[model samples]
Target: MLGAGAVLGLLAACSGGGSGAAPRPTSSGDGEIIVASGLDVTGSDGVRQQLIHAWNLTAEGRKHPARLLELPGGADEQRSQLLGALQSGSSQYDVVNLDGTWIPEFAEAGLITPLDPQVKADPDVIPSVAATARWKGHTYALPFNSDVGLLYYRPDYLKAAGFDPDSYPAAGMKWSGLQTMIRQLDTVHAEGALPGYQRGWTSQLAAYEGLTVNTIEAFASAGVHLTDPDGHYTADPAQLKTGLDELRDRAGSEYTLRGALSSYEAQSLSDFTAGRTAFLRHWPYAYRLLPQSLGAGQWAVAPLPGDAVLGGQDLAVSAASPRAAYALELAKFLTDPKSESCLLQAGFAATRDSAYRTPPPACPYVSPPAGSSPSASPSASSGETSTMPRDGQNRPLYASGTLRTALTSAVQRPRTPYYGAFTQALQSVVHGWLADPDPPDTDQVARRLDTALRRALAGR
Candidate 1:
């Protein structure tokens, strides 16, 4: 079972028509299992490639070696490529790495096959993460890695502003408290106490899926759910107004960096690392990369205020694959407890609880010799080793505590079969309003959004 608010919204019109015909089985059994996935953010020779290589050395893999096919472009572009390939039956993708939101869409369209029942009953998977693998009472994918938004802050800046960094809340604080700290940091910046300080915080607010995610976080914080659990348009003018007000306040010009208007993950991370903002709203991966730029004790991380969105990819066997059996085994091997521990060490939010609680043995896949520099290590990202402080148990110091707390309570974006349409409608309306110098009244915006959403959900 998933935590409260962990499950995605219900059914909607399916996106991209499928052939509805079963893929022809292949007679040749010697071909490699090709895995199609989005860019490996872990840099070249990433942890994923390492794990796959490890599997290839196994007795089973010697007969059927797997090759990783990294897709180019952002999430949207990758989705289109996958859908087109799967629909046309042109590509030989035995396994596909899909964003959690795409589970309903792929499952409803029969692009991916249901996973084994044993995988569905695996209790080691996080409750919220396990829920993402299922849609309409069947499991279509297995949780690979999990994601949740986290607040990355410059503790050095807080100290310079006469605040005790040690006194900061570890459990989490409300948005109002964060605002007060931001104001103090601003005052200090004005006095030339902090260099390159432009504003309180920055986040991904571009007119893409990032904007949709940010908007949903604001709406959830205000207790405004735009859609019912069944994915029906259920928001009223008042509810929308409340949600919009919260978004506007948090993202107001006075509090946020102007560059955030066109920023995505890379841009936001750059801004934060450049010392342009004291606070940043980003995913868990940033935790590893940030240490590359900011030295030890210079910054810290905590759970984001209000609700954070759940993210991460799931591994699914392509329905058209002749090597479905091998693909299934690969998925299981990649998400097994040992692999998950390796992911955690590499800075991903592991889906298994054991990765956090249990002491990890050396990553069997890629182990560097003792006392090697980051550049000398195979797991290093962009030639930089992670300086993320770890506990005595070898887990990230924040992993079992702060990070786990956030994941347990994180919320999901609307879970509709037509998620592409739903996100497009939401981002278009929201970004338009945010971009306006003199936006219309909340009621007018609300009406426009509601109508647009209804049309999108209804597949009009």
Candidate 2:
């Protein structure tokens, strides 16, 4: 696995460069509230903290200056701690930055307060992202930063394999057609046609949220969802079965990353950016790290053959917050138009449509001049990331406008209050056959998944 530390300087440059120092912690004085998230604020998560510092210097009116409350880095740990606090109706924290998928879970439990009149969806915000901020018709959170999965491929390998770099992103192809492409590419990779290219494609398949994310995307492309808009379980066994078979096949490609069974986005990206794989399925953040790792034009992002799964975070006010009104103001400060621009410049895919209207000044990736160090001491603040590196000067359609369009067409993961349970059930069902040599019994697997989802949603 690539140590995340190896890429901090690159991530820093993508955000228009940052000082290596973590922001000195501020005292939580009378008028200041705390923004608690699973971010280090001084390390990989530095970008957001710097933004907070910038916001503090100008804060006035109902908005109180905010401080950072460091939380455990593990996503689950943060969720657990926040839930415990909310369940106890404590207001030690005011604003909570949550994974987009958690909005339903937190809001339904009354753990997070809705934005209400303080903030609401706007025409400038991406519709899909805006939708994630609302639950039961209330705007429960504000989209802070956003993400969608993308297909990163090497044109050199594709051209060597006799595939046209021109005829891609191949967004028109469904997963079935993508499977054929993968097989052909797999054959080419095994022949050593592209030096150091050891795999056809690599994606997140570990037994964690990433697996569920990939599963939902597969099901969406297959035209089945775990539930309908009303939140009822409505998975189609036949489609799900077919989708599982495809995942099994993608996982079986011989050239697939050898470390795949244990890999997540970081490992997968390290392989691709390191020139070990022909393709990688990862979020936009990879763009910021690639330029530092690869030579110019070495890699590019394209729309996945299927609907990309949306990934990102949102901000919600804690219901128990004594400073709910001011916290709401703080949320606005962090997500407002100006802040959104700062996020984009820093490499976070901002949620507002306006941010994308004018392309960000920096390309997602910029190779620093030769001999420039690839790292800097990053503040532990937060990393709001984006994809698409400027090749020192230009961005192709795939890296810029095309991606914003894809976000409009992207598929969201299931919007259920029991998202945690649903994701676990999904991980179990899919990973069971991911490494199996023999073809899976699709019917049996589908039955198991359906039951798992049912039990999960039913609180089993």
Candidate 3:
């Protein structure tokens, strides 16, 4: 199978723009920064409109005056449009948003230029946010909306488990650990104290981005790094075995809390917000809907369990553009703390340190109900709550800040060219393993995986 990066790069190379020719846009323009962004505004058109409004306001007074245009259509269509934009020598759009994982592919294809030092030197921008834009030691796209998966829990349920609300493992916590906790919670829920209480954990596990990202987190925490230190796939059999075994066990276990294996099916997020799950593994965007879905105080949020990998997107400028500087300036503005907050307010998590550190009033909680004015701060302001693995209710019974610290220290998924292929192959193997009660010959599995990795790495 073709590795994700190679697939993209190959597409880029074959797209007729490999020689750095800028696509000629049917509509030519100067002075305005056209942004090709992908924020689906179909259902919540009002919210989508609000985001555009907020962005327009924040982008005003910037060094360059920008005209942000929403790029319509699906991802494949969008990708094609972006390529067409770059190849046609058209300056229709200066900035474009990319999935966080797509940064490498975009950069490798030379579709975007790296950020200039002048923008990095700006005091208004956060370095952490700026750093996310960098590709190959150069900044390409500013991190616009930043999101990391977190564990959502009910404090009431954890209290029933006899475990202190605090003291949940921050980093290095394993999915196996969650399995144990869920079993305990199920036992308590069956005791009839918590009637509506279901399984312990819920997640989107239908072979999509969420599944791949979650699996990476588990493997990373299990000490099975996806890519070698040199940023390439490794043939570490023991590491792979341990990681696969843990995943298979978790996947096969029927007692996984509701939040553990809930298929997104049709309306997973809607279902999640409806409070059908006890614990959820999801991105920060879900924060906006909790109040409406689970009711206030019923749901709580914390950083993802040990070694949870970060899943989000980044922004990049087209390298072949005539106005590279202008494109980057627009990119910088889009990822600016103020801009990030706007995106966050619009329901995405801002990747900037400032936005994350000095969260808007809605930081770590639901925003005011839909169509309501945004809050300046969280309503229930408590002291720095423990971020460690919490018992249940999002309350921090553990030491303050310990959870986030642990999570940050935990290993992240492999940032490699072959990440997609590796993950798909692993998923197949792991799924089969989970389905079979009698453990198949793991040796055969390993051989197949090893062969698959070698083939993917070789660009077959």
Q: Which candidate number maximizes TM-score? A: 1
TM-score of each: 0.90, 0.83, 0.71
Candidate order by TM-score, decreasing, is 1, 2, 3
lDDT digits (tens) for residues 1-460 of candidate 3: 2234533332232111011223333222355566677744213332223333333333232334455556776444565677677767665666777765666656766777655554444443344334445656665666666555677676556666776555552345566676777778778777776676555566666654556666777676666775653346775667667776656555555644433443652345654555444567766555544544455445666666566665455767766555555555445544555555434444554454454345333222222333244532232212221122222222222212432333334344555545455556666665555445586676667676667766665446
Worst 10 residues of 1 by lDDT: 8-17
Superposed Cα deviation of residue 197, candidate 1 (Å): 1.1
Question: In model 1, what lDDT does residue 142 have?
Answer: 83
Error of 3 at 384 (Å): 29
Judging by TM-score, tell me the better candidate of 1 and 3: 1
Judging by lDDT against the true structure, name the best candidate.
1
Q: Give a tens-digit lDDT track for model 2, residues 1-460.
A: 1134433332332322111221122322356677888753124535576555554544242246778787874666788898898899887888898888889999989899766654544788889988888888888988888888888888776777787877764756665665566667778766766667666778877787777777777777767777765466876677678777656656676536777766877788888877777778887767666765776557777788777899888988887777776666667767776566556655567788766666433322222222234542231332322233432223323434656876888888878788888787778777776756674578888877778888887667
Q: Give the TM-score of candidate 1.
A: 0.90
Minimal lDDT window, size 10, model 2: 16-25
RMSD per candidate (Å) reads: 8.4, 7.3, 10.7
lDDT score at residue 260, model 1, on the 0-100 scale: 92
